[model samples]
Target: MNIKGAIMRVFPEIPEFDEVDFSQYSTPYAAVLIAFFESGKSGLREFEEFVEKNGGTKADVGRFLISIFQYLLIRYRRYGDEKVEVPAFKVFLTLKGWLNENGFENDYTRLLHSFVGYLVDIAEKIAEKSDCELGLAYMKTAYLLTIEAEETFKEEYFSELKKTAQGMVAEIYRKCGINGGLPEKREKGC
Candidate 1:
């Protein structure tokens, strides 16, 4: 819903899309989310076509792409692997291509940090609407992304995002009956 709200802010002409019913995990909404994931695995053509069809400019599509990527990653962790094959390498390449085409290739640390923020929000949304397991999956995804971004970007913002993601993951694990949660200190061995 946050992603859809962000998209509508850019392309208001697009009508309201269907709300995803979390109870129905295999609903059309899930399929659409998987479609976005699959599209990203291949390339950004689907996103580009969406922008053109919706009368949006390249400059505006960056946030939209970022939003969908966050959602796609969430869905992938939730149900994508069971539904279809999604190679992680291809997704990484597509993300790189998105950054390059959207003019963030040279300096994308901020954008990646921004994505971590969205991931947190998405985890909260899933927590509210779906099972704690699904929410935990999103939190785990967010935490992993933060780790990767922190390694690649080395930005100060990533430290904060990583902490936020770690905190969320800890809370979710606590709720899931995993006491003590993840270690607060990042392991030197990891």
Candidate 2:
């Protein structure tokens, strides 16, 4: 099965929304949504296992995810890349708190720590490269990739996935009201 199939199987009840309204749900729910969009199937599996092992329901998992998302967004807004290292440490502290509260085993906690780190890294990259807002870029990348992967698999059109991904990113930028023009790279000393 494709990534979309994997995601739907893992999160069958995810609500439909054109834009993510973080306020509509608890942090946990929002976190799961972010993870769902950002990390895809593997991220889903990691979250599901963490919850199951710790006797956590989906909401508990969502809360943990949201905490990470909130930390990253706050850091991004405040620092604007000036203090990258500090934000990473702060986010780690947040994840550690959740792991302690949930009584996750040492091994499991380490795995989640890494996963959270990965999610943050990807989000930061998206924010830096795209014209879309950080949150919207996160959502759109995941959404578009899943669709592209599914169609590619069905059509056996494997060669153009890279181009398709690029197109999706550009489309997302346009939708978000960014010019979506490729910035001309300056060549070495004119």
List lDDT for all candidates, in order: 0.52, 0.44
Candidate 1, residues 14-78, lDDT tens digits: the string is 23223321232222233333444443422345555655555656655555445444444555466
**What's the lDDT for candidate 1?**
0.52
Q: Which pairs of residues collide in model 1?
A: none
Model 2 weakest lDDT span, ten residues long: 15-24
TM-score of each: 0.43, 0.27
**Worst-scoring 10-residue span by lDDT in model 1:** 81-90
Tens digits of per-residue lDDT for model 2, 43-67: 4446667456556674566455445
lDDT of 1 at 46: 55
Candidate 2 vs. true structure, TM-score: 0.27
Model 1, which residues run further than 4 Å from truth? 1-17, 20-110, 179-190
Candidate 2 segments whose C-alpha is farther than 4 A from its true place: 1-42, 82-190
